[model samples]
Target: MPSTRSQVDTLESGLPYDYTDDEFDPDYRESSEEEEDEVPKTMQRDRAKWIEDNVEDIEFLYRQLMRDGRSMFGDSFLQTGTINTFANFLYRNTTPFSEA
Candidate 1:
């Protein structure tokens, strides 16, 4: 049976000790990769349009979530439901735009 110290040493050896290298830094990503990942103008326009269309609904939900602590709804209830709705809204909007 392995001793606890040896097991811990093995685990530590498998982990990265330094993250300063380029491979671990997002800002060090190659220029070509950045270019390939850039969103097209049309897609950007579509995303902007989608946001504009949903701005009112987003604002309304946000206001409800930002209400004073004395409101009838509990913080947990408001946070959970509002955040879930916002996430769902983003996911639904992304599907159409992303596939285009």
Candidate 2:
């Protein structure tokens, strides 16, 4: 019979994983990896045009009442989803909000 500790280790090892270093990929993370790895060959040719079409950045800030004056950056990147959401917000930002 397997003990709790052994069962936990088995479950943990079977769980799944993905990283830039992974040679083979699981179906779930494969598509995402492709998107991040290749940004369309056409875009790579022209730096300005490429950046204009695909959103990108290094820093961000949220002026919301709760998180007022707060900011985000590459180091603050929690994960792919979080970074994507914040980056999208910054890309579309046109004006700042005030707490007053």
Cα error of candidate 1 at position 36, Å: 15
TM-score to native of every candidate shown:
0.36, 0.22
Root-mean-square deviation of candidate 2: 11.8
Q: Compare the candidates by TM-score and give the number of the best one.
A: 1
Per-residue lDDT over 27-99 for candidate 1, one digit per residue giving the tens place of the 0 to 100 score: 7875673464345566766656766777877777667656743276555545544543553456445556453
For 17-98, candidate 2 gives per-residue lDDT tens digits of 4344464645435456445434334434443343355543323332231144234343333434454444434433422331
Pairs of residues clashing in candidate 2:
none
TM-score of 2: 0.22
- Sliding window of 10 residues with minimal summed lDDT for model 2: 91-100
